[model samples]
Target: MAPNDTQVSFALAEPPVETAPAPAEQLRTRFGTLTIKPAHKLEMPRGPFGFSDYTQFALADVPNQPASQFRILQSLEDTEVSFIVLPTAADNEWIGTADFEAACASYCFDPTTSGLLLIATMRRDTNGQVKATVNLKAPIVLDTANQLARQVVFTSDAYTIRHPLEL
Candidate 1:
């Protein structure tokens, strides 16, 4: 049959069985009804400073228009607590700054790294008007390989501990 034909049928293929093994369990967390996949988990090596007690967190997808927002779901025993996730700057201009870029480079995070700078939102404001701030000085830097992470503190006075999320 021609490529345009939708009625073409071929039955020579053996029953498809385990052609691709399941993805590694990357983001395993007992949050919500579903157990999140491993890829979604952000590796917190020392865990969050204040939240050192609970290390593993699931960064789940946030449902809404404007795709920037996400849910940083934390597991608290049988209960799951989720925080809104937002970037420090709406635009990545600050990343180009010498100090910021240098800090990232020291951690071997080049421009090609799939690094995500996320801040846990305090409230779930559907209106999206709530003040979204990021911990600039102490940012969570994750090493995509081996799922390792560390919260590094940048001494640059250029940034702030809480910077307003501007569009």
Candidate 2:
């Protein structure tokens, strides 16, 4: 056989490797349960708001009922103080600030696939009527595929920390 023929035969003889997919990440929280991936956790550089000392977190699944839907969840050491997440869908006319893009850029998270946005919150009253707001001005931008994250602030005046969900 010619040299080229031998190379071709060798290439055809090798079989492809088969592997099983990795298991999903599941974390238990005080508010609820969350099914996430190890790559989905975004550690805050300086930590988040009051939980600056707490770095570890897990994104929990929100079972959207007859009311609003939750897109993500944030777990802290307390577990009882997890934050509910919401997506900034275009239909909601949610516009990000200019700094938002820069924050993602710092982490090298592409805007295309890393377009997912998340917000967190806390409840002040037991009735769930009194609720504090999250910082929408600086939202946590996460790249789900890579499990990378960063807090990005929008320079635009459109987004604010007090943008009520009612609107």
lDDT of each: 0.48, 0.53
Instruction: List TM-scores for all candidates, in order.
Output: 0.58, 0.61
How far does residue 86 in candidate 1 sit from its true spot (Å)?
A: 2.8
The 10 consecutive residues of candidate 2 with the worst lDDT sum are 6-15
Q: Write the per-residue lDDT of candidate 2 for residues 78-132, one digit (tens) a residue.
A: 5665666664421123554345456667888665445434464645567757554
The residue pairs that clash in candidate 1, if any, are 26-38, 27-37, 27-38
| lDDT score for candidate 1 against the true structure | 0.48
Off by over 4 Å in 2: 1-18, 22-26, 37-39, 63-68, 76-78, 89-92, 97-99, 120-134
Query: After TM-score superposition, what is the CA distance of residue 25 in candidate 2 from its true location, in Å?
Result: 5.2
lDDT of 2: 0.53
Give residue 162's lDDT in candidate 2 (0 to 100): 66
| Model 1 per-residue lDDT tens digits across residues 1-167 | 11122221211112235566345333334333434445555555456666665666554444333243434444433234444444232125444356545655776654234243555444446787565566667766544444444566777687677666543
Tell me the spans in candidate 1 whose CA falls farther than 4 Å from its real position: 1-35, 63-66, 71-82, 87-91, 96-111, 120-129
